[model samples]
Target: MAETDPKSVQDLTNVVQTLLQQMQDKFQTMSDQIIGRNILTEHSLNNDNAVLKRLKEHQKNPKRVKVHREVYLKRNMKSFTLKRFPQ
Candidate 1:
């Protein structure tokens, strides 16, 4: 990164600028995406909200459901009438 070659320095500078621009563009797009999203921050969720009420209710009355799984593996016996080819 501390090379004395002018061409190398210019290339490095260009690459860094391009990378910075790309990162900025990505950050802007991410910010734009979140602009209209219904995201809840920690402070907001801790405040008086319906989501907190629902969460408390869910914790008090958690549902219990039973799950059953069945698996079977079979191997068929085979009689080979085939011969191996010589290399």
Candidate 2:
């Protein structure tokens, strides 16, 4: 086998460095895209806050249910109830 030359080794090193830099740039771009997609932007935050405020206002005046009395009469009661089974 022929012995490798210094100049050839240096060229290989330079090529490896260039490839690593390109990969780093690609990874950075992919990371930026992922972060951008997952994170909420300023406009989205404002819209979310507006929706939450509306929901809070609606919840402030919730409906009330008043149960007056329960009369246990034999004619009004049902004889059977359905049983639920878990899958």
Candidate 3:
């Protein structure tokens, strides 16, 4: 086997260091983006859960207008009478 030159070995080491640093930086950027998206997704899921809870509560106790036919007739008559009188 041939002996390697010291200068060439140093140059090779420097190139490998530079490539490793670039890969580390790229990995850090990707990790930060993934973490950010996860946080946003978690926040959105929480909001959706809150809205679903409110909807379920509303369904459990819904506002219902129970009007008897006689009451409705009386109200209708009164309105008709007022409209006829124009006062």
Q: Going through the candidates in order, what is the number of backbone clashes in each?
A: 0, 0, 0
Weakest ten-residue segment in model 1 by summed lDDT: 65-74
Weakest 10 consecutive residues, lDDT, candidate 3? 61-70
RMSD of 2: 10.6
Encode model 2's per-residue lDDT on 1-87: one tens digit a residue: 144333687877987888899999999999998889767586688899998986676577444111111232322343222223323
Taken over the whole model, the C-alpha lDDT of each candidate is 0.59, 0.64, 0.81
Give the candidate number with the greatest TM-score: 3
Model 2 is weakest, by summed lDDT over 10 consecutive residues, at 64-73
Residue pairs clashing in model 2 are none
Candidate 1 total steric clashes = 0
* Best-to-worst lDDT order: 3, 2, 1
Q: Estimate each model's TM-score.
A: 0.36, 0.46, 0.60
The TM-score between candidate 2 and the true structure equals: 0.46
- lDDT comparing candidate 2 with the true structure: 0.64
Better of 1 and 2 by TM-score: 2
lDDT tens readout by residue for model 3, 14-87 = 87888899999999999999999999999999999998987787676655223344677899999999999977
